[model samples]
Target: MRDNEKDLSWWQTFKSVGAAFFGVQSSTNHKQDFNKGKPVQFILVGLVAVILFVMSLVLAVTFVMPA
Candidate 1:
C-alpha cells in the first residue's frame, strides 16, 4: 500500500462501480480504486448493480408496454 492510499469501504467501492457504469469515472479516482480497491469487492458490487439495472429495465418496459 502506498503512503496515502487506504482500503476502500463497500460504499466507496459501490460508488466507484457506479461511476464506471456511467463511463464517467475520473482518472484520479480510477487510479485510487486500482490501488486500494479489492477486485472481489468490485466484482461483487458490479454484479449486484447489473442485476438491479436489468430488473429496472424489465420493470420499465412492462409498465410502458402493458399486456
Candidate 2:
C-alpha cells in the first residue's frame, strides 16, 4: 500500500466484498481494494458471507419444502 493510501475500514471491506459477490464492484473501488485492503480480511469476510448465504438458502428450502 502506498503511503497516501489508508487501510480499508471494516465497513468498506464489507461493502467491497458484497459488491464483488454481486459482480457489481466499480473499477475505482476494485482498485482501491486491491491496493489497500488486506487479503486475510477480505478472505475472512468472503468466507463468512458465503457461509451465511448457504445457510439462508438451506433455511429457505427447509421452509418451502414439505419436510
Candidate 3:
C-alpha cells in the first residue's frame, strides 16, 4: 500500500523482464565447423568469389563503348 514499496516492486519486475531478454543459457550448444573440414570450405568459398568477380569484370568490359 506504500509508495516506496510500489517503486521497489516495479524495479524488481523491470529487472526480471530485462534479464529474460538478455540472459545467456549454458545448455545450448553453439554451432561450429570442425577444423579438419575447414580448408575445403575455405577453398570453395574463395573459388566462387573469384569466379563472380571475373565474370563481373568481363561483363563490364564487354558493354562499355570504346572511348
Candidate 4:
C-alpha cells in the first residue's frame, strides 16, 4: 500500500467487482473503487464475470439434472 500507487491492480478490481456482486462490499472499498477505478474497465470486467457465472451455473445444471 504505497502512497505513490493510487489505483487498484487488475486482480483487486476483480475482487471488488465480485464483492459487489454479492452485495457485501465494504464502504471503504467502494470509495476506493470509485476514486481509483476506470468505469469502462470495471463495467467490462463485471459483464465478463456475470457471463461466466451464468455459464457455469448452466453447465452445472446440465450435468446434475436427470436427463
Candidate 5:
C-alpha cells in the first residue's frame, strides 16, 4: 500500500523470509536430521504463522468491522 520502504529496509524483511526459507530448504535436503528437530521446527513455524494470522485478522476487523 504505502511506499515499500519506510522506517524499515527491504533487507530486514528479506532476511526474515530467507531464514524461514532456509529452515524449510535444509529440512528437505536433510530429511533424516530434520526429522529429529521436525517437531520443534514445525511448532516454531506454526506459532509464527498463527501469530501473524491473528494480527492480520485483528487489523482487518478493526478496519472492516461494522461500526
Candidate 6:
C-alpha cells in the first residue's frame, strides 16, 4: 500500500458510498476510496442503499396515492 493509503473503516465506507450515490464525492475522497476501500464493501453498501431508496419511494407513493 502507498504511504497515503490506509484501510477504510465501515463508517468511512458508508459515507463514501452515500456521497457517491449523490454524485457529490470530492476528488480526494474518490481517490481515497479507490486506493483504500474494498470493492465488495462498496458494492454491498450500494445495493443496500438502492434497495432502501426504492422501498422508500414505493412507500411514499403508496401513502400519497388514493386507495
Best by lDDT: 1
Supply the global lDDT for candidate 3. Answer: 0.43
- Overlapping backbone residue pairs in candidate 5 total 0
TM-score of 5: 0.42
Model 3, span 1-67: residue lDDT tens: 3334322233333333343335531232111122122344445554665687789998899889575
Q: Residue by residue across 1-67, what tens digits does model 5's lDDT show?
A: 2345233233433333445645654444344333333344455555776688789999999999887
After the best TM-score superposition of candidate 2, give how far the Cα of residue 42 lies from its true spot, in angstroms.
Answer: 0.4
The C-alpha lDDT values of all candidates are: 0.96, 0.94, 0.43, 0.90, 0.52, 0.91
Residue 4 of model 5, lDDT score = 52
**1-67 in candidate 4: lDDT tens per residue?**
4467577788889999999999999999998998888788798889999999999999999999999
Global Cα RMSD, each model: 1.4, 0.8, 20.1, 2.9, 13.3, 1.6
Task: Write down the worst ten-residue block by lDDT for model 6.
Answer: 1-10
Ranked candidates (lDDT, high to low) = 1, 2, 6, 4, 5, 3
How does each model score on TM-score? 0.92, 0.94, 0.42, 0.84, 0.42, 0.90
Query: At residue 19, what lDDT does model 4 achieve?
Result: 96
Stretches of model 3 off by over 4 angstroms after superposition? 1-37
Model 2 ranges with Cα > 4 A deviation: none
Q: In model 5, which runs have C-alpha deviations exceeding 4 angstroms? A: 1-37
Worst 10 residues of 1 by lDDT: 1-10
Superposition error at 12 for model 1 (Å)? 0.4
TM-score of 4: 0.84
Candidate 1 clash pair list? none
Candidate 3 clash figure, as a count = 0
Highest TM-score, which number?
Answer: 2
Ordering by TM-score: 2, 1, 6, 4, 5, 3
Clash totals for all models, in order? 0, 0, 0, 0, 0, 0
